[model samples]
Target: MTLLAGTWDGVYRTTGPRFDAAEQVLDCGRVLRVRQFDAFDGVFAATKSGLYHSTDDGDSWTDLDVPREEVYSVVGSPDGDRLYAGTHPAHLYVSESGEEREDDSRSWRELESFQDLPSREEWYTPRHRNEAHVRSLGAHLDVPERVIAGVEVGGVHVSDDRGETWEERKDGVHDDVHHVLVRGPDHYVASCGGGLYRTRDAGESWTRLDDSLDQTYFREAFAHDGVLYAAAARSSPGTWRGERGADAALFESVDDGDSFDVVEYPGHPEEVVLSWTVGDDTIVAGTNDGGVILRDGGEWVEGGRVEAGVAALCAL
Candidate 1:
């Protein structure tokens, strides 16, 4: 098995139960997401530099030239005909042609209607000098035309027409969204700085899932094999540098978010698990402190270490 770690410095790859000797494969900066979609070929990386595609198992990468240099999120249409790239300024772009096209022939058109959201002017974050970003994008095969977007400091929004027009869904959820995990056409889990939220009617409403837990600042949520996993810090990243470090905890839900049970891992309280992927029969988690952990024999154990903090992960 091969594991790809997207970090602040670049992208690294390792084929082992340990990542101590992981090698850098791509130099794209601040990789926010490394994912693979059944509708699309190869692996996609969303980075501060741009969007990249790797076909030969992370051996080489090709820039998709998304126009915007800082791509925070990328997703493919359910039909695999279109590719979406969300940028730092909260702009959305779509490529009708897949990334397999040549660089000179590939084109991406801005989804201008995205700026027409009624709350567009309010999508600013003080951390980014009043600039916000589209931190998460999600699409489900059950709803081919529906596209869900979670914006940092902005809110959650849905576009039924596939990025052409949008409806505000963040009314009941916190605006400091980090990731949106889609389980079905109407089911989604939003990880935000304020709380973790769940929606059943396609984001028309949301319920907080972490009211009983101490950790509130969630970065991402993942669901696999009927199990839900979420890791969160006590507060925002600003408080992650103190003596307690991130003070983070990992939560698991087997009953689909109705309740959660805190699970212990190798790096508890200090190193937050920032990314997750599945390799073979093992569940893999990467941490902000460069720790690689695996779930073996139904328990979390230390697997290895990478050179830099892993922001995203993909297993092939």
Candidate 2:
């Protein structure tokens, strides 16, 4: 088994969710995403410099040659032959499939069509330069041909032809999408800068599902066994940096996101869980204060800690 984690400080790997056992595999810049692929027994980490991949557990890493300096997200095909990287300024790069990547370095090809998605002229970032970013990528495991890209401050884009072409869908969502969960060809839930949006009929339409929460600034969400979990703050990342912290908290929904209620845990009323993943039948989360928490058998407890906010987690 292999588990990889990304944090604002660096990227680390461990036997599982045990942070005490984690070893810093890379001392590079902020790690934003981590992906594990079984086909090559490979682990991939995205950071400020470029994309790095390790085929031999986390003992070694090779930086894939790509022009993008800030890689924010990554996803792999179930077969492990294909890989995709989403980066700053809202760009997507895909690896050439159906070949062994053991000795390949410049294996990624830029998909130029992504920049032509609808309202392409309207996407812009508020805090930085006048450019948006691809913050998250979701691939349909059940349907390998479909993929979704969540653009921060730009909305979500769906590709039925596996990254060759894309259709922009922002009907029930604000332009600022933080993460998108794709359960099927027609089912998806998007947690955005404005609120949470759900779609039962693919990308035809979406409905805001965050009416029960006081804050609309939602970034991440996950669903399992018909139960949906999400977190929210008074605003964006600004809340996590302040002294008081965003009135950040978690919530659960049994009605497929129609409504939600607070999900109690240790120190339930404080702190924000920014990243999540599942490990050995338990729900795992990382907080803004460099904390890792897990819910095993319905009880929540601390797993360990990092020195900065956890950006991503992957278990394989």
Candidate 3:
């Protein structure tokens, strides 16, 4: 399987043997997220400028005319036809069904009255209009009707009606949810600002599980096989005492999300750990500066080094 990574310098691609780099510099200032539409054949990258699609594996890219340029996440249907892009100020864009064009401005929907919902004030405190930043989106693996979204400064939002309506599912969850991962029916976990939290009741309630991870910015979480993995980055610590210990860490939980054991590394401690994907039993952890490493039986093996840093890793 091939993995795609987007960074400030450019876009990168990796397979079994070689690491290829596509110099798609972030002239627009920043690139928030990146994803491959179909395996490694096509990629969708979001930056301050706008959304871009690379069908030729980053050799060339085309701008996707999303409403807002500050897109943080993008997800395509399982078939890679229907595309959905989420951005700051709470905007959603749907591609013109089958049309994919650079200047093609499709119909866009803005979620404005979210704070008017019943649980708005309680769940989304300091309810600012553009603060409901949607960071991540995932289509349920088994359920087509359920669409999960992760919002910054706000808890998880579940849309059982296919993004038409959303409800705050933070009953037992802490605020400042950053990422969400769905494993099965009730097996789902969220990575919040404080740490990682898991809920068997979908998201009605949650229990914090970030004691082992020393991070105030839990960026992403993923599950493969029977193991659950989470990435923690020390962006802004609660106190200055923990500033010297600021480093990224990747944790693995074999018995679901109950407890975790640190996947030790030989180099410097990691910082800003991102997403990962598993192949066979080899778990790969993408970090801000430490490149990628393969978690073997009981050790972490160096995968390789990247000059632009790793954003997300997914197996095609």
| Candidate 2 vs candidate 3, lDDT winner | 2
How do the predictions measure up, each by TM-score?
0.97, 0.92, 0.81
Residue-level lDDT of model 2, residues 1-316, one tens digit each, is 4566788877877787668778788877788777765544677888878888877777888887766878888888666666888998789998866533566565678889998887888889768488888888877667777778889878888888878999988777888888888777679989888998998777679988887678788878988777899988878876665566677778888998887887666544467777788877778888777778887777678888777778788776
Question: Where in model 2 is the C-alpha error above 4 Å?
Answer: 37-40, 79-81, 98-103, 267-269
TM-score of 3: 0.81
lDDT of 3 by residue, 1-316 (tens): 5665565555566674223332333344456677665422466787767877766655566777777878877776554445777777655655636474445444555545454556554433344453666677777546655667777766777776556677878667666776777677556788887778888776777888876656657877877777787767666433213435447666778988678877666333535566576655567766666366677777766677667556666454
Computed on alpha carbons, the lDDT of every model, listed in order, comes to: 0.91, 0.79, 0.65
Cand. 3 Cα-lDDT:
0.65
Ranking by lDDT: 1, 2, 3
Name the Cα RMSD for model 3.
3.9
Best by TM-score: 1
Which residue pairs does candidate 1 place in steric collision?
none
The alpha-carbon root-mean-square deviation between model 2 and the true structure, to one decimal in Å, is 2.1
Q: Count the backbone clashes (under 3 Å) in each candidate.
A: 0, 2, 1
